[model samples]
Target chain A: MPTTITVTVNGTTRTNEVDERLLLVQYLREVQNLTGTHIGCDTSNCGACTVHLNGKAVKSCTVFAVQADGGTVKTVEGLASNGVMHPMQAAFKEKHGLQCGFCTPGMIMTSIELLERNPNPSEAEIRRGIRGNLCRCTGYHNIVEAVKFAAAGTGGKK
Target chain B: MVTMTSAPFEYMRPKTVAEASRLLSKYGGGAKLLAGGHSLVPLMKLRLASPQALIDLSGVGELKGINSSASGLSIGAMTTYHELESSVEVQRAAPLLADAASQVADAQVRNFGTIGGAVSHSDPSADLPAVVLALDAVMKTATQRAGRDIPVERFFKDFLTTALRQNEVLTRIEVPKLPANTGTSYIKQSNKASHYAVVGVAAVITLGADGVCERARVAITGAGPYAVRAKRTERMLVGKKLAPNVIRNAAKRAGAEISGSFNEDVHASAGYREAMTQVFAERAITAAVANAR
Candidate 1:
């Protein structure tokens, strides 16, 4: 029997019927239609399905929707407020942090959390922080620059 | 969407260790303990493990903490890799352990996976087993029948198998404090894509007066069916001077002592893994010796 789980996504609370085995990525993309969180690999190898579960970044593909019941989830789509890009998103755009953009959402999400923890991270720390997220298009030179750019900006709004 | 393809099993979330043990005792082999489910979930997705019941230990409060004591350090079974990596206690007592924990699968896997789950799962490629063996830690297991402590060497029995019997739950891991002037290092060659260790070597060495080796403990992972101690290399180094020549020779023996073939998955070949094992052993020993000094 499927369980009804109530979750707060992108500042909206919604109740949905989720199978015990349904992954959180599918729930976000299919049911909630928040396709910003991409699923690059069904296995946990790819960080394309990254999201903030209770303010912590996690690969949604590895987590069951039911496991996130009653938790607050922030998807890539939630980063923008009033149609304005978040600082990390704007930094990526300004610095050309992405090329293919398939891995951009996850990369941005993970970087946002990383910056939150350590605002003035060094180049090596930034690389280590985003080591889990893989980018195929851009060689990550711009991404590192984007994180530094975002870190220097005072206003959260980009 | 990846859904559970196996037969439906009874799921019980136990709030306490006693409740979990009771469920395990009742279900016995039919029950499987669910920690973070990072290791077991993937197996179940492929229909590898189909237990009739699952006892979820996520709610267990007793099995979660990283604290130090007069004896040594005690890490709760439910401590996640993220917790270990950021723990001040772990960083102070055994920095190598924190380093190994940081190298686990990835950020996501480390956040969800528990240290106890990794140790109990006994995956040959998992990093903590090698660290545990090198630290000479003790595993505490509890059951409805009784509770006992098993040395890390004997805790792992075979491939994907542990010394834990049916209804037994691994409760805590007790890591002994290193003697004075001791240093440890862990080095591994990880597959870039999966981030699983292809071959990992961890060494703990204590330097005696006059720069002689007082004691040596070495362990290797991802090289065979289970993590094995480099007993021969350890014996050769003890009582010897801590010099590059001795370290190189002992490291060579350590690599040579690792017998049997490693699992040749999509990651790497048996030959490449064997070669990497030797290289990693040398580097790990050299680094550990420097730290000991």
Candidate 2:
């Protein structure tokens, strides 16, 4: 069966008839063509498909797209304004937080939510905050540093 | 193979609990209630569950929020882990539950997973079951015909099973506020990857004016088919002061109530969980006793 859902993606409000089975991650990638949200692990474990459902970070694969109906969704592509990098994105680059970059989008999305909950998180808090996300490259040391830099919020350009 | 998407199913989001109950009754076993979808949705994707319809409970206004009462807290079934973890009232009233909610899976799962959902799903390794069990919580459910309140002791039946009927929806969870001079703690030997407790224990200990043990509620999870109270341990601790030696001896019987065989998976062998159960029970009781004023 098809479920008609009206969702505000990033900032754009749109409605579509979607299969009830479609995952939020699949909807973001296939229907909207917003490929920045990577599916590093189709299962919820890797946290590669993390996105903000109405400002709360969730494993997109774990949520059916129909569940996001009438809600706002923010993805990695939604982070920046007018091509300027979001502080998190800039921090990842400056702190060398990626090797293969498959988990970067999820890591960044999850960290942004993490910093929102605890604006000034410690190194331990940052690591625990992003535990859902897996950087298979074992780039955690730099990833932790990048999250710290992002939480610092002073280095990224406007 | 990675099955990323759920199978086809009809979805309905009702505004009231009564309507949802009616829908649940209509579909009977063909439908499943969708709370946070942290458990059911994942099961659907893996093809383990293929319900014909999903009655999404997120939109039921009555099924959300936390309310304080004379007895304890009347928590709406849709209350998420994040909500429970971050709620100031929950922190003060049932800190053990709040802390356990924080330790479930991780941030992303916590953001959406609900207390009612977890309780209804009844995953043996889930942290909340043991906490609720130790807290002597009450689970309320509704159907088109009537509503039933099942005590936590009778709530969990077996592995991935509960006393909940097919046509019923768990409405809320009532967790009691700990009395003054009482303290509680939940500790677990968790799987490194999934964070599910291999052997978990939740202890609630109240001290008398004389500093002797007044009452104790100890529950263990993950070591067996489902969470169960360590009645022998609780009985052993009630009249006596909780010393390390006393607690150690009492905790040895913590897994004795696990009927039939213990749960053995890749994460833990039966014998390993049996040993860890005693260790965690002792640690949890010691921690709770220390926390008591």
Candidate 3:
């Protein structure tokens, strides 16, 4: 049987009729037309589908939509405020943190969380913190720089 | 074939533990309890685990919280790893749990994975099975009629199988307070990709008044079918002073508890796992002793 669920996504509340087995990642892209969350790997690895559920980053692919019915989700699309990019997003753009851009959204999502947990993280901490989200672009040098840039504030090249 | 989504199944979200237990009884083997869904969902996606129904216990209020007393801690089964890793009470009561829980997987997994689901799944390579076994945690379960408590020694049965009955829902795990002068540690060589432990060892050691070994509990996981106590190693450490040589010799016997052949898979070969078990056992015991006060 299909269940009616109300979930607050980004800042908007959405009500959807979903099957029991629909994954949250699929629900976001298919039902809600939010494709920012990408699925990079079948095994819970790669972390390409990272999103915030009730303020904690999680793999959207592994969670059932029903499980997240009453929760709040923040995706990459939710990062911008009134046409202004989130600091983490701005940092990524400033540091040239993309090659193929396949894993950029997940990386941005995870980096924002890393900074939130540790306002000023060490280089090793930044690397360890983003270990879950993998960028196949193998451009981790700039990714780390981007996180540091965001952590160092919006100042130019701190 | 590896797929990305779970197969068709009925989903039931119960608001209470008793209702969850009743749902489990109603569905029997056809029902699989969903907690965190970190381990089971991946299997379901790959078609490795398919069930007719799923009973999600996330909404069960009774199955969530941490109650502490002089005796020990009663952690709700639905508590997430992030909660366990960050709880001040858990850190004060059983710091080894918080340490091991923090190292279970990456940060994202820690946010959503629950200790109960990990323990119930009994994946041979999971870090918690060995940690819980060494800590001597008691699994508390509920059914339609009553609840039962099963000690950790008998809880884990085989690969991906536990003593959890089909009709019973695991409610909480009771971890006894560690006596004074005791310290514990868990160490694992995780697989590079999945981060599952290839060989993990957990040791809880208590030193006597004279600094001689008093009581020791050790468990090994990933190298065998399931986590089991390293009785031979524990027995060796009971009376001897935990010098470097004695700890090394005792660690050599850590693999004696495997009743059958060692687990062999893409993660590690049998011989390599057996050798690494002894290595990690020594590391875990040494680390435990260093922290023993």
After superposition, the stretches of candidate 1 with alpha carbons farther than 4 Å from their true spots are: A154-158, B1-10
lDDT of 2 at B286: 95
Q: What is the C-alpha lDDT of each candidate?
A: 0.85, 0.89, 0.89
Compared with the true structure, what per-residue lDDT tens digits does model 3 show for residues B104-127?
Answer: 778899898999999999999999
RMSD of each: 2.3, 2.0, 2.3
Is 1 or 2 the stronger prediction by TM-score?
Answer: 2
TM-score of each: 0.94, 0.97, 0.96
Can you give the DockQ of every candidate in the order shown? 0.42, 0.67, 0.63
Lowest summed lDDT over 10 consecutive residues: which window, candidate 3 chain A?
A149-158
| TM-score of the second chain in candidate 3 | 0.97
Across residues B1-293, which tens digit of lDDT does each residue of candidate 1 receive? 44554455666678877788889878868888988878887676567888887687877888999889878889999999989998999998888889899988877677788889998999989899999999999999887667899999899888889999877889999998899889899999887876778899999999986888899999999988788898888988999886788877777766555566566777887777777777888899889989988
Lowest lDDT block of 10, candidate 2 chain A: A149-158
TM-score of chain B of 2: 0.96
Instruction: Give lDDT: candidate 3, residue A82.
Output: 95
User: Where is model 3 more than 4 Å wrong at Cα?
Assistant: A154-158, B1-4
lDDT, candidate 2, B67-99, per-residue tens: 986778999989999999999889989999899
